[model samples]
Target: MKINRCGQAEALTKEMFQKVLGEIKNDSHRLIFALCWYTTERPSAILQLQVSDVYGSARVPLEKMVIAARTRKDKKTREVPIATALRQELKAYSAPSEGYLFPGRAGHLTFSAYDKGLRRVFEKLGLRGFSTYSTRRGSLTTLSRSGAGIRQIQALSGHASLGNLQRYIEVSDSEVAAIAAML
Candidate 1:
């Protein structure tokens, strides 16, 4: 894994992501990370999600989950389609009727609290440099590798600009070699 500046978190490969997810024994915490991975949202926005934003009257997962504008770094609300993995996690979790999904005394789950739990998981797995942002960056990189258009990823991630979004994508050496061969 490449070490980046303070603001940048190392992106995990899909296998590494699964390993991290499996290490998380807490159901709520597992769901939290799954939401982060699948929705490609920041941990703060994911933590602030209202139960209604994810579930309907019968506690069914919505097709699209809303990341509230207020919690977003760019303050732009985006509806992310729930991936199958995230939907399964949501189903396993018993969500409350209303209010924050991960509620804390201060209103919603504090970033520090979430980070603490994440840090423990990482330490146990001997992973260094991975943060809550890892999932978001990983998801974007995965999308880019899968041939999704940069504009599509930008929309999904709600990035203010393509340049900012591009920074999150990690180009593999093999991918570069393949492009060189094509040339």
Candidate 2:
């Protein structure tokens, strides 16, 4: 099974999100997953984020919450903005502007380490096949199904094109059955 398709892509009902958040032992881990769900950014981009990227004068109206990060992917830099939920979580974990958002033991956020942690979390939660990337896919899929247009999703997800964005949204057999029933 595709790692991204491991489980339900629905936005992890508020209760489930809270449950998973509660299971996290540390604030950093909670912030990591919260940021992932809010930004819908890839693990690499998220791990690459630095404190400066989230702050700085360039981040205008910072008090309004929701900051954008310049992500380097596909030979281009795409700006992805955070959501309100993530902003609040970030505020709670606020670190110095020169440090890493999710610092590792070595003092830098590493995608490999983060992925491993996420895997363990999934295992402990008895969820199979789901990977860290599932957060991105889940966020995008949820947004798409909730009446968000392709362009809006592409912008928020930093996808270069609608085609690329569509690939992340997996319409399952259950959805098809529901649609047929409606018809």
> Superposing all C-alpha atoms, what RMSD in Å does each candidate have to the true structure?
1.8, 4.0
Off by over 4 Å in 1: 1-7
Best by lDDT: 1
lDDT, each prediction:
0.87, 0.67
What's the TM for model 2?
0.78
Question: Local error of candidate 2 at 172, Å?
Answer: 2.1
Model 1 scores worst on lDDT over the 10 consecutive residues at 1-10
lDDT of 2 at 24: 77
Q: For model 2, which pairs clash? A: none
| Model 1 per-residue lDDT tens digits across residues 1-183 | 436426578888888899999999877688889998888888888888899899987999999998889888888889999888889889999887789888789887788888889889988998888888899899999999888999999888889899988988998899999999998
| Backbone collision tally, model 1 | 0
Model 2 regions more than 4 Å off? 2-16, 56-71, 105-107, 181-183
